[model samples]
Target: MSSFLIICKSIHLGNTLKIANEMAKILECKVLEPEKVEAEDIEEAEVIGLGSGIYYGRHHTSIFKLLDKYSFKGKRVFVFYTSAFRKVKFLNGCEDKLLNKLRKHGAEIIGVFQCRGESRLLGGVCKGRPDERDLARAREFAEKLKKKFS
Candidate 1:
């Protein structure tokens, strides 16, 4: 069992998966999609990351459903997401529902990471986002998490 586990869904342009991989590198953990996560994986992880592309103002349905099947009570969690917008203000609402669900389940939110993703809509708005700068920030966030839990 790894000390850290990140359950990620990167259905759009693999944006969320990129961030997940960055964090996984720092934390030395595995990035598993929601469907592939087993009960023991969640149980043994010191921290869990739930993330996906923002769809219709929230995370993918699969992420929410993953929470439905498992409990995060008393567990530490970090939420990450990517969308067409990069500003924190705009990203706030994107994570609200997902964070609210985590709160309701008594999960301790350790941190949040967000960045602009090339939305393959409106003729690919935000293209080239989650570029080098965003990836560096993601690495930094994961390093912080590793130090906090180390």
Candidate 2:
């Protein structure tokens, strides 16, 4: 059986964690906060999923630091994110940064998923998001990823 790891950085609201948890359930994988994951965990994962909520137009700095701390050569990677906007363009910068880092570490990216998430910042945006529909989409993405990598 292939091992999968989902590393996520979530803020106080836990919107990103919610999405990560949904994927974890679908993939039957383990999920951990970035701070809790170690280099060995990254090295051991055959397929890695990195997820976060957008913070200042990018993934939380913690996720970037985690990636910097580990080397993921020859791993299959997937990225998922929740943000105030539904359009991929709004999250492109964050997605690109993660993609570049994974590529730099010689990882192959197999999929990407994005969805709207409630944010309290700026007086709130995307209220009630990552809802049932969004989670369903995430589950579908996970199923596809499992077929591709597992």
Candidate 3:
């Protein structure tokens, strides 16, 4: 089984990390915090998974910095993000940016997995409730990713 390195970073909540952990367990991938991993560490893994909590329509700074510092040459990279907005347009072009960055370093971009969670603010989707269905969908997404990449 080829090993993978999963890194999750968030600003307010760690839902993305939790989901990534679950997927790592099933995929037999090694999970690490973005702050604890170095650029060289990423080079050793066949796959790299990045997860983050969306804030103000963007990923955390730590996640961006990790992507900026590392070269994902010849690696399979997956992206997962948790957002409250059902339709977030600001993030529309981010996947392209990430893919371009990874490709510049000779990496293969596998695709993205996203899901909706509870909204913290006064006005948003399911403000006080996180639908069980949403998490289940996240799990399903992980399963599909495992089957495809593993």
Candidate 4:
């Protein structure tokens, strides 16, 4: 079986995990929650997926820290995020920033995917997200990942 790893960190309802787990199943990948691993321990995978909960329009601390410690050279990397706002263009910056970072580390960026995650704060603007539609979109992205990296 091909081995892939998904590193996810979240501050809220674990939406990142939910989506990453679903994608992992599709790719037959291993689940590596960064919070539970040493920085060096996460380097064995050939392909890496980073999923994060967008905090203040950026990735959470745990993910940022892991990115700082690990280099992505010669690896296939994909980024997925759940955001509070539905502004399609607003997420472009975040995705670009992540892509830039990965590229700097010599990673082959497969793609960037985003979905609306549940937001209980601020009057529920992003409420009821990672719903069926979001899951379908994520799964589609996962299929693309399989084709590219498999």
lDDT of 2 by residue, 56-144 (tens): 77788888898678887888888888988655565456688878888998888988888889988768888898799998999899888
What ranges in model 4 sit over 4 Å off?
39-41, 88-92
Q: How well does candidate 3 match the true structure in TM-score terms?
A: 0.81
lDDT string, candidate 3, 34-103, tens digits: 8899877797787788877776566667777887787777888888777766644564543445556667
- Give lDDT per model, in order: 0.89, 0.86, 0.70, 0.77
Ranked by lDDT, top first: 1, 2, 4, 3
Regarding lDDT, does 3 or 4 come out ahead? 4
User: Worst 10-residue stretch by lDDT in candidate 3?
Assistant: 122-131
Q: Cα lDDT for residue 18, model 3?
A: 64
Clash pairs detected, candidate 1: none
Against the hidden reference, what TM-scores do the models get? Answer: 0.94, 0.93, 0.81, 0.87
Clashing pairs in 4: none
lDDT of 4 by residue, 1-150 (tens): 346788888667877777888898898877676777665555677778888888876777677667678777888888998887764665546666677777887898877888888877777766677898888888888988887777
Q: For candidate 3, give the lDDT of residue 89.
A: 58
- Per-candidate clash tally: 0, 0, 0, 0
Which numbered prediction scores highest in TM-score against the true structure?
1
For model 1, residues 45-118, the per-residue Cα lDDT tens digits are 97999999988788999999988899899889999999987556564588888989999988999888899999
RMSD of 3: 2.6
Candidate 3 off by > 4 Å: 88-94, 122-125, 128-130
Question: How many clashes (backbone atoms < 3 Å, residues ≥3 apart in a chain or on different chains) does model 2 have?
Answer: 0
